[model samples]
Target: MQHRHACERRETGGDRWTEAEREAVARDHRDAARRHRHRGGDEDRGGFRHKTFVRRLRKCFEDHGRFAGADLTRKQALRDFFEEILLRRRLSDHHSFTLLGDLRDAPAKRFPGELTRRARALTPHLLTTDAAAGRASSARPCVVLVEADPASSRVATSAVATAGGEVAAAFSSQKAAASVPGTVLAIVDVPDRGALDAVDRLVAAGLMVVATSGAGSVALAVEAMRRGAVDFVLKPYTPEALARRLAPRFAEVGQHVANASEADRAKADFGAFVGSSPAMLALYDEIARIAPSRAPVFVTGESGAGKELCAEAIHARSGRAGKPFVALNCGAIPRELMESEVFGHVRGAFTGATEDRAGAVEAAQGGTLFLDEIGEMELSLQAKLLRVLQTGEFRRVGEAHARTADIRIVCATHRDPQVEVAAGRFRQDLFYRLHVLPIRLPPLRERGADVETLANEFLKRFASEEGRAFRRFSPAAMERMRAHDWPGNVRELQNVVRRAVVLGEGEEITPEMLPAEVAAGTQRLLLERIDEAEVEPFWMTERRVIERAVAVFGGNTARAAAALEISPSTIYRKRERWAELGT
Candidate 1:
């Protein structure tokens, strides 16, 4: 019972609550309730009701505080709501609270039983003054944001705020040294050794720290780890990354909401990859959640769905971001040379080995190694890769000495690893080793509405690159694109736009520039099914015949008119009219 009480005290706080102190806090709360009921005026609500706020408050409370007792539960809950929501200032005495509505009289103590009843029902019965009593004052275990550099502070602050954390204050090393009490976690934007020293000091003070750097070195990271940082975030990172690193730690301390709403907010694009579809957003959240670890990450996506982009984002968010990000395409390398290419060879080891060389593992020392098309690597190489992953030990080709790489492995393949394992093409043990955190990217076709957005982005980029006046997609073109099934995914879309930007002339890219199957849409399907029964306006039919003839003859106007039995000038006039109408 003594041991259990010690643990409970730690949960509530380091100093156990005295019976007098609990009664004092309970009395303070009752006085505040009285003031709210009698003298205080209410503020107007735009659309949100106080009840709705109460529901959210309870949900956040349950998420952050898993308090396990009825003895002081009401006091604890009311304290959390006031501190976390209202952010009320601590009383001058630090032993009790001030009443609401500027009631200058000191709150008088009430009987213990009455105090308990009022505290129990306080949250639901909170008046406008009770909840709005104090603003922006704080207490112990507050999460602090420390960024010395003024230029980068905004980014770091925005990241932490977007993650749903209540930042107590922003300070530098000077201010931190001045005020170090009761900080839960300090996310320091480290730009140099001075910041590292601050981190070490904070750690020494028993404050958890997350060190962030934009252009950091391996020495900084290693030293930060030695000084006891919980995690390291590379700068210019998304808010989700900062949030994820803090999430689990804050959950343990009863300062974070590790719920679905927070996870869903991370659905926005991460780094270079763009999408808000549930799957992509989930992938972004997963990356943010796992980027701090040194575990091997396996990424799977169809060809051109940007698997490599995901790998880069992971490496960027990880502690190893300051080091080289070496990438190798296992399928692109020759089978016979794969071993030497990965592990390297000494001079004269092979016919082409003119001098000693290092491979991907060595090149990526103290960083990340991204292996694309991993499933296509030969089976013999798979065993060697697995061995390295298992023991972090490897040997160079034709060399007696062994070598090890301090590198994180990120493997990617378009084919399903399970299917490959079943077929005996991929090694089962190797798959398991690299599959600790698997990120499967959805094909572009499955991400609805993202297609049009992606199309607009691509078109805008290509327009500037090609120096074209092209701006928007015509309504007909956008509808056709949205309806068309993109079998080739993002890569195919990029290529189609690139071709159109090069050949297209008008401001609006019309259906004429789109592929036959894509542009025809409903009409194309009808034509394919009915063969000869499809009808069209006379001019439209003429236009189709001329287009087919010109396309077939490689844009030779004379040949096209000859194929259609029309004068060359007549075909030219129709083409000019179409161009004039921006079609």
Candidate 2:
């Protein structure tokens, strides 16, 4: 039986408490109040007793206790129980649930059209989307940030998340004076000398600390680095600045294995993307070759093939690197609102129009405008976009003034623009103007062993994300991945790896942990066939299979041996003999 006498009911249905049982509940409320009056707790805090009772009940259930003769897992039982307790008329307070605030199960209040009318006086602030900002996120660094004030903490938190850096935890000065283990970095917002000790504590715990402060706190910023901080940035933080500072750290995993010459750092990395394939290397060279040009570039690729990353890399390496890279998805916004989203609207321009707003073009002034899924844009909007490209001017909705946007255009689409033009769905003139420079990205299936390389990088990244001990994939699991054709490309691989990290508890991932569809695909792997007509020697065929498996599994000798059903020492000796032969 439940410990609360008021909550206990003789009826099997929780909501069927009779008038006599309600009287018993009212009496219990009065008796509890009488006992409370003699104690040192507040009597005016209206829903205190009910809240305390609910919390205690939840705790008891979590600690392995159960209500008498009742199955808590049944949906109706829980619903009726909450309804009875929450709706009960208390003898101590008239309006029982008013004190529960927004937590009460009720419809949210709305001012409707009145709020829209009032919003005409309010203005919305806009942030510049640097070309770097328009790219899809790869992996975020796991880090903590400390701030003394609530307002500053919230500001810092938003900046970190926007930049693809996960803030693991936020702490104030009064919290536990320690840093969390396994955190890659900590950004400390030091208000004064008092907070300096916290930075030192984090450093002593073997964490990399970055100290930050406002303009007036230069002395503190300097002192923090002097004590132990690895880096420093001034306050009034922007996500772009932080991203640029940590760019190297984001690509550190690929850099460890990237076999690039000193003259070819550009070949090894482009924004957040990293790969060692010949196609990727060639793409990197092409991006580097065109960074100085202001000509409009149209990037074509299958979905999830990193078209946005290509645009971001060009912008990051170009002259407009300091300016915003504004990205707008043409397919995502409605045709009616697309005008307002791409161009600013003055207040009273429409029904819910607020004050003045800067559109993506204005935000990208002197920078780059990345238009994703441009093929999906309405034909009418395409004409308007062409005008902006022809002449650097565009007017706001409901305004006569024509503003000039000095920005470079970087457009991407998975569809063929020429096909769209031939079908009359896209304007022919606009296609010619934007397609001055064309770059094509290859699909993941054609990238060969890069699938395993990308998968391993994701493993390390998501292991940090989910706070678990996930290391590598078992040999059979790796072989399973190498055989399946990833039609969804890199993005699909990222999601699968993240899911396995979240769900799999073992140190190494096995084929059983794969998604149902992927596991089915693994059964259809194309293996070599043997024939008596004409074939290579048995030993040479075995060597070739071993070599192919080693390449696909990222050159792991042990994993290759397991996949080939051979001993690790055998493969090791074979490699040693091959190296000696220099064949």
Candidate 3:
């Protein structure tokens, strides 16, 4: 009955709650919260008394069933209203968390927009303040106008602002467009070849460029496309017409521009890492949360997955940012001199020890010591290292007195430490001591579009170093790169991009310019898919290979097994099963 009355009242009130209705609903909520408190249920934990909150939410839904009008979807309308209410009410953090959690866990079908603004605005410490700031900055899409004439630029800026966008900056030259940050798009009036070159630079900076050319300058339009302009418009276009034409492009690239801006911001915080993928962002958040601590951090990842960089990031974020960060590669050093490398050597300690020398630990005093490939450290050394960690003291080679150590230990290993422990190659206690805080880096293949971000960054860097004209990757080359499984990870990708920049002569890198291995593999996979009509069963294929191997080995199963890297008993068992199946 109350829901029906609310709906009728809402219908009469022109699809919006009246001031009296809002106060009545707010009063009801407060009364329910008071009742919950009187029932001995903590307000912080209960979060608006779940049952009553849902009842109110459903009532609002019913009253506002047609509130979306035609332009706004029901989901968006609910979210906008909810956000406005939250802002007006100024809910407590605990209440907001509980409310957002319930909304987050609910099915997306029931709520579109997922209350993204609300969740981002309410998430504790993660995006709360930053999200608010981003919201403010993104209230209007920002456009950069690159027109040489002052009067024309003023006109364009006013048009853009009037068209529901903000003029982030107005530059008279295309050369200045590349430096503009947090822009959705750039409007470039290309009158000459120099402006066309500027279009290239802006595109290289990841901004979508819209080149405006005179109607008779068909050659200029063609050149603009070649120079990487996404869309070109003929001059003498009106604000409404231009806006209509560019609206679709803006919608398409809006999210991408936002992400690029976010990545740029993230670069300021995580200097060594260059990605905004969810995995990377989560990793960044984790690093920030854990940076202030003094616990030893153990980083584990594939050889080129940036374990050392992760350690550096942790150190940079920690209290030791201003201190020295000494890194030692345990695998690169010889086992015979491992002890002397970790602890400084006294004079006359060995044949080469002519004078006193400080090792990595000493060099890293009051800072961080990054030990890469630590699993390669011998058991004897591991035991000694464990003592230093426990006692905070170490003795130099051939020294009788122990020196105090005041440094954080951050160790990394490509190999599994547990496997080394089981093999008795590493001390168990040392592993435990360093493994207090463990960070596992995801391989590049799993980082998704981060591959593109990293590839572009590497291209820009290497292109300048090599003094090449390489500006960007051709679409085909980029697709092939994203398709390939990067076995060697980021290091391999870096080398590939560097090689392409060195050998390629054109402004855009093509598929042929890529290393033969990556290009050929892509072609081979495509050919395999197209040429193979019938797929053979795994057992048939396995039998064919095994039969061929046995024939090549003169019918000796053991020799074939040895060549195939499988047990001879396993081959015999497979042969018995094949015979029974009459294959």
Candidate 4:
């Protein structure tokens, strides 16, 4: 009875009791048990609880006897419990113990070391493989496993660790952004659509992501790629396959880091613009001719036709290349703040203005100011702009003094200035002033055969950004690209190429990897054109025939008319009329 009480007291005191106190308790328990055995007392075996107590005491004695020479701590007791309950149950083969509480607060010194020893003992067989265990232990790159399902967490951790990566943390989508660090690669098991928000946050932080799910939906995979995942591995992945998939990505990540180290070495080479079409070459020539001059250049093109790039080229090649090159989208600024943004403003000029501020024009002094979407500017502001263009002088809001403008202006617009002037939406004088050195950028469709070159360029850029090993597009994919009309222009083409880079599973990008809208739109348009049988007006039919012939003849108008069995004079007249009608 005395020994039973002593053992209970030691168990209750836990790690707070010293080893000497534990030994004293054990001695007292042995003395009482021996006395009870000699007396053959049925009182100790009167109930099941007494029997269980005796059994626990005997097991403790056996464990202590086995490790009698070594010192034992309360943490070792806990570890033994874990090995019996968790490890024996196959809950986890390898343990990565992260101490949650401060060691200074620990009641005993040996607790931490005992726990560490136990974890070392359970190291799994798979972790001993050469490819799996050869990574640096101190500088291990963090691999975050995001899984809401408890059942898959162990499997994911084991597989990732076997691939020479460490599972830094595990989190559900709801907690991923807050828990994941920037350096960690987020591996998400997105089981449903609700997890997309978590995926989006990970992407916004610029963390490399790898998503998986049991569902084999290609749409989900595509969506994951669109949200900036580096790769998507389906569930039930073997350790070898997981390692193979991650190996190249790890190498590419190393390259990206190396490249970033020498980022300044990469110059904005004008030769980097990838296109050999006549229109592109002509635009390049125009940029070269006008870059050295201080003229107010006007760029016109459909949206996403690289008008801003043309502006950049001009600035980069000009004397102002060494100076600041400021760019602003006229359409993006709020109407109420447009004047204040363009010209200097004094304190108290507006609600949010607490101090005097220089406007964009003054900010670009001695440099080039690129005004994108200039047609979106209000007509009232156009007159003030014309004055600045004519006299190079302007005044700040709520200020009495006038300031001289010393900046060069480069403007771009997708709208037709003639149409805006006819509609009384733009001042004709301002239009004429801006049109002095007009340079119209041809759209992607008009660039003819440049699509493949631009696609490959974008493919390389996005692949490098994503840390993938994709090289090029398949032949069928290239044919599909050429067959489609890019209504969103170059921007659309860039997005498609980026999407393909992310979603492609192999080195070559396939048509199946393209967005359904792109492939479907081309097919639908082709079918619609083929099914059309209605006869149109003679002029309309003539225009259609000429357009088709021109496409077939690769934009040779003379050959186009000859193929249509019509005189070149009639074709030219119709084209001139079409141009006048703004078709």
List the candidates' TM-scores in order: 0.46, 0.47, 0.54, 0.45
Query: In angstroms, how far off is 295's CA in candidate 4?
Result: 1.7
lDDT (Cα, tens digit) per residue for candidate 4, span 1-583? 4434544554555343344545555555455656766777554222213443334433444443223213234434433443343332233222212121111122344334433223322222122222222322435455666787644665565455555556555567776653344244667888777787777887787667888888888999898888888888898775557767776766676667655433322223455455766677677778889999888999999998888888888898999988878888999999999998898699998798999999988898889899999999999898888988999999888889889988788999999978988999889999888777889989887787889888988988899999989999888888788778888888999999888887778799988999876776567446556744674568787677789899999989889888778888988898899999887
Could you tell me the TM-score of candidate 3?
A: 0.54
List, residue by residue over 1-583, the lDDT tens digit for candidate 1.
3323433564666434444443444344444444544655342231223333333333333433334233243334434444533433223322222222112121323223333223222321111221222221243235566766644554454444445444455566555552344456778777877777778777887777888887668888877878899888887776567767777776655534333334335433364875666666777878899899999999988898998888999999999989999999998998999898888889989898999999888889999999999988999989989889988988888899889778999999988899999999999999999999988888886787777878898999999999999999998888788777677778888887888889999899898998887875656445446746566578888788889999999989999889889999999899899899887
Candidates' C-alpha lDDT: 0.68, 0.68, 0.75, 0.69
- Residue range 176-276, candidate 3, lDDT tens digits: 54646567678888887777777877888877788886644888898998888888888777656677666776676767767777777788899889998
Number of the candidate with higher lDDT, 1 or 3: 3
Q: Candidate 2's residue-wise lDDT over 1-583, tens digit each?
A: 2323424432333543344544544455555556755675554444345544433333322321223223323223333343354455332323332322212221224222222111110100111112212221235565566776544554554455444564555566445236464355677877678888888888887667878777467778779989998778787766557656555543552353245442146434563785767777787888888888999999999998998888999999899999998898888998889988888789889989979888888989999999999998888888889999999899888889899989999999999888999999989999999999899988887777778888999999999888989899999888888777787889988888898999889899888888877776666574323344666677667678889999999989889889888898998788788678784
- Superposed Cα RMSD, model 1: 21.6
For residue 341, model 3's alpha carbon misses the true position, in angstroms, by 1.3
Specify the poorest-scoring 10-residue window by lDDT in model 3. Answer: 122-131
Candidate 2 error regions (>4 Å): 1-268, 527-583
Please state every model's RMSD to the true fold in angstroms.
Answer: 21.6, 27.9, 18.6, 19.8
Candidate 4's TM-score reads 0.45
Best candidate according to TM-score: 3
CA shift at 305, candidate 3, in angstroms?
A: 1.3
Ranking by TM-score: 3, 2, 1, 4
User: Residue 378 lDDT in model 4?
Assistant: 95
Residue 221: error of model 4 in Å? 51
